[model samples]
Target: MEQNPNKPKILCVKISSNQRFFILGKEDGFSVYSCTPKFSLLFCRKFQKTGISIIDILESSNIFALVGNSKDPNFTTNKVFLWDDLNQKSIMEIAFPTPISALKITTRFLFVLTKKKCFIVEIEKRSILKSFSINSPSDIKPSNSFDFSLVKRDSLHIAIPHKLRAKIFYTNITKPLVELTIKLNTPSYQLIKFNCKLTFLAVVSPSGKQLLLYDLLTGELYQKFRIANKVSKVYSMSFTQDDKIIALLFNNSIVRFCSIQLNETTNRLVKIENQMKNVYKKNLINIEDDTQGICEFNEWNDLLVIYLNGACYRFTFDEIEKKITDTVSFNYLNSKEVLESKFNFNIEKEDERKHKEGEETKTGITSDKLNENKNKKTNENIENELTDLVELLEEQKLEDNMEKEKGIF
Candidate 1:
């Protein structure tokens, strides 16, 4: 029961931050697709059996960072290639001592993470801008666990977990200008992400079963929510460009999308699970292996998920119906028309929409404060108070659902 070696299989997907392009790393090589104005297969590069394990595109450009992986890898695991699609060649290459585990490319720099060290490269100059190392590093391969935020107010922020602690670095240059450190509780964290604003941090607790949110400024835990009560490996987690919503994909048929609300008045980050939506397709995962899917968000809060099994899906939220609808789906392996998808979105109006939503959330939080004054509760009493709150919220949701059903009947 062996699959054909010549058959196409999407190994991973890397989406551009601008929502204009995405790279699909296949068993042969990689292909590029236009994402914003139109969804169409732009071009592809084949490397025989050499497959890309990880890739990061530089803001919808022809240039991208790649790390190869395959039974017969064309490049070594410790090497990274900066390939220029227009030229169809590797414009630059960097060799690391340890196997390159993960990488990300931004407008200014390319961040590469190894098991023992982390290196930052300036894309324009094509030079290693700076390198950082921990006294001791973990041997685990980080997937969507390590991430850095875009430059905001002059500092580029990086988050990497070392010795079970998340070490955050803030700098604008090769030399250290500033640094911030945060430590978590007894449980280990597998995923570490900073919101685009750098105001909040999200991590996976208990091996991706639960999500914990912390304030990056104070390293104070704000909220904790169980993403999956049962055993489900989280495949990926991504925040929208506007930082309004987050998408999480488990190693199953479930892709969960939830709204994120920040109550600045209370300094609380609230994950509205009631607003959560799931896109379920039994074939989303390979089911035979640990091949993980990728999930990302467009500026308009639309979602795109590419599974390793070659299924690509696009989802849109309908505010009028309070629903998430799977607008389009196609398999990249079988369809050359993946680029012909007509789901065009306008990102220019996203800023205004975010402002309006922020105002509405502030209003809602103000009214919620009037209903419950548990802000001053002690940590020792928080467990019971949270239980009561969850029970009350569940009852309210059940009643609302029943009323809706009655109206439909």
Candidate 2:
């Protein structure tokens, strides 16, 4: 399954659970497909470093989606087969450790984050070259839930929410490295969660029913405003590509958009000049449906809104008018639509790829179950030897002490 060079660009939003892979298309169709990972590894290895194909292994079923311009000759999997569409294939043989938390692909590396750790795999070799630990005891508890973004200019940022704090990590290093730790001023013991795009960070405080905005580059607080109490939870928040406005979704079926301005001044009081104007407010058609997640604003200026029931809406922004409107709904589950879409399928594929048995997984441990078994056995042997040695030393000391007492008597 390869991408068609001639098709229009579409955003593919995939959510995986134990049961099925929920796929939301940018065009007008949504479908649930079974995702398995067996053939996905085959496709990835065959196409490794060639940049000829992209493969996405869904978690729910044995099915996978393959997209790109060329197909790999060594790709194989009985459980993994192409979907009905000629352009994309669905694989059903492999599965991920946990549902994907975040995925990013660069020219040099593919990064995937699960609930516990971050995996960095080589795109060219189809092998995990490095693994990074993300969990640490801090004000924020390490959450299995998180999101990541690559800042084009100088850095990469990861946002993870623990019990009450959202920790942000900057992943860029240079001659003079830049790092900053900024904590959100929130109510005591209340969680202040956030979603990050390239330029802006959107923070949602549901306990207080407020949305806070921050400037990523300058570390300046942009806007702090309150939402309605009926808005039970602020599930998702995102900013436009230009950083001119922010969109927020609440549990109460209300979607709100506000205009934003950059107030740069020396005086703190005078810095808060421009007021946010409410652009649009709409009751979601499916009031009872759960929101899938907040969609990242793509380069095309389209904001994706995913509902928990497998429905997704693309909202386009009018910069001149400061208005946001729904552009289209993605409902099609065909392979051709997925192949033709221009959204970076490369990163998405990297996120879904998994290591096989005998191979090294991202945790830096061999995927071979036998390897772990052997390590455990070896550890037991060493422990037994150490225990015996300690006992012998203690007995010898006691014997020496007793002989000295006898000699003195």
Cα lDDT for residue 67, candidate 1: 84
Off by over 4 Å in 2: 1-12, 15-102, 125-145, 151-155, 160-167, 173-176, 187-199, 206-208, 217-220, 263-277, 289-293, 296-300, 322-409
Best model per lDDT = 1
Model 2 gets an lDDT of: 0.41
Candidate 1 on 97-186: residue-level lDDT in tens? 888878887655678887767888765565787787642224234655467765631356776665434443333343255555666653
Indicate which candidate wins on TM-score. Answer: 1
Q: lDDT value for candidate 1?
A: 0.59
Write candidate 2's Cα lDDT for 1-409 as tens digits.
1223453223344443221233433222223332221001111112231222223332212223433232333232111222211112221122235433445444334456555566655433545765555543232212213445444323545544333344444333321255444455553212233333344455555363666665555656667666554435566666665555567766666777766655344211112433334666756674464443444454455555655443456677776776664466543322332222222222214234332344322211111332343233322332242233234333543454466421111
Weakest ten-residue segment in model 2 by summed lDDT: 37-46
- After superposition, candidate 1 runs with Cα above 4 Å error: 1-4, 48-50, 70-74, 134-141, 152-154, 164-177, 264-291, 319-322, 337-409
Estimate every model's Cα lDDT from 0 to 1.
Answer: 0.59, 0.41
Error of 2 at 347 (Å): 20
* Residue 239, model 1: Cα distance from true site in angstroms: 2.0
